[model samples]
Target: MSRRLITEVAGVIEAPVERVWPEIVRTVPRTELGEHVLAYQGGWWYRGEWSVTPVPGGTRLVHRVYDVAGQGWAVALANRLFIGFRERTRRSFAEGLVHLGNRLGCATRLT
Candidate 1:
């Protein structure tokens, strides 16, 4: 039995997906690269995906965290008990986008 818990955050970077892709791969070396997605799996349950999409002015980057455990309910419960899990995830993504922007020499804004 598999239950899944997911959270997603997205931002727009003022650059093309082509430009952002290499940097993402460089920054996250252990990812499984797909068309526009980078996937990372860790431990027994954690799965993370970063996807890029072309927008009018630049690229949209979305990060999603998934609990892919058979006991995902327990994982969700533990996360709830941990407090501020969602907030921390969002904050971390925001910081990451800022860092990516610095590296790319471009602007980034949460979407």
Candidate 2:
């Protein structure tokens, strides 16, 4: 069995993409650090990418995580063992972005 968990929080910044991109790279936590590929910013997780996209006025960011364990009781046990995983992950990303906006002196909206 494959077990994956994904969560995303996105918002638009008031600045242009040029200014937003570096803020993302420099401000986002090291744990969520990722590189920009084309119009998307994403990082390598165990089995997924926390991807970000550039919008007209600002950028959109996503936080995603995938936990994979092959087969049976082990997977089920692990899943049950972890609680509030999604909420915690989501909160972390959301807070990170909010903080980034504050630091950048830009307005943002969760979209």
Candidate 3:
């Protein structure tokens, strides 16, 4: 049987919704699977979403990765066991958040 794995990470950008939204829309690498929904294609059966929400002082950006079905389980196991997938993903997200901050000329607080 296949097991599903889901991971989520979020950060707050210290900028207004007006400022943050555009950069997120422009910089976040994704495929337009639907209106207001962006997807990142992952290794073999993995998929990801980049969701942005407006907050009082800034914008909250959440990234979610999902692994489903048989192929997904196999890839997730291999990545976790042999490749340290969690750490790598966290690092990548951190870097991307920093880049986004730099682009927006403000600070990004990871939560």
Candidate 4:
């Protein structure tokens, strides 16, 4: 089965679309947000990508990660064998977006 996961963050950044996309999509790790932005807690590391777009009210952030495999028999029964993992990833994205919003909002002096 093909596995897909999508998460969106709106109003996540106060900076202009031009100003935010670069940092948001940077390949390097940012200390402020921690280097393990997308690492799986007790498993092998995997690569992930993030996208940003300008929406009517704010910017939209999207994250996609792939090739995630399950550890045991439980996963065989699971639809994607990575449901919990994807959920954790979703939470991580939400947190980073919220933090990014606060940082950019402060920088932009947007109340």
RMSD of candidates 1 onward, in order: 2.4, 5.2, 3.4, 7.4
Any runs in candidate 1 off by more than 4 Å, and if so which?
1-3, 72-82
**TM-scores for candidates 1 onward, in order:** 0.85, 0.64, 0.75, 0.54
The number of the candidate with the highest lDDT is: 1
Candidate 3 — number of clashing residue pairs?
A: 0
The sequence of per-residue lDDT tens digits that candidate 1 reaches over residues 3-109 is: 36568899999999999988888886466777888888887777788989999999999988876676535756766754776678899999999999999999999
- As a whole number from 0 to 100, the lDDT of residue 56 in candidate 4 is 56
Tell me the tens digit of each residue's lDDT in model 2 across 38-76.
222233224434456777777776555655543434655
Q: Poorest 10 consecutive residues of model 1 by lDDT?
A: 70-79
For model 4, give the RMSD to the true fold: 7.4
lDDT of 4 by residue, 1-111 (tens): 233333332334555667666666464342223422332222342435455566555555556664434343354554464557766876776667666766566332111
Residue 67 in candidate 2 has what lDDT? Answer: 59
Sorted by lDDT (best first), the order is 1, 3, 2, 4
Error of 2 at 56 (Å): 3.2
Model 4 ranges off by over 4 Å: 1-14, 25-45, 68-83, 106-111
- Which is superior by lDDT, 1 or 3? 1
The candidates, ranked best first by TM-score, are 1, 3, 2, 4
Global lDDT scores for all candidate models: 0.84, 0.60, 0.75, 0.50
What is the total number of backbone clashes in candidate 1? 0
Clash pairs, candidate 4, are none
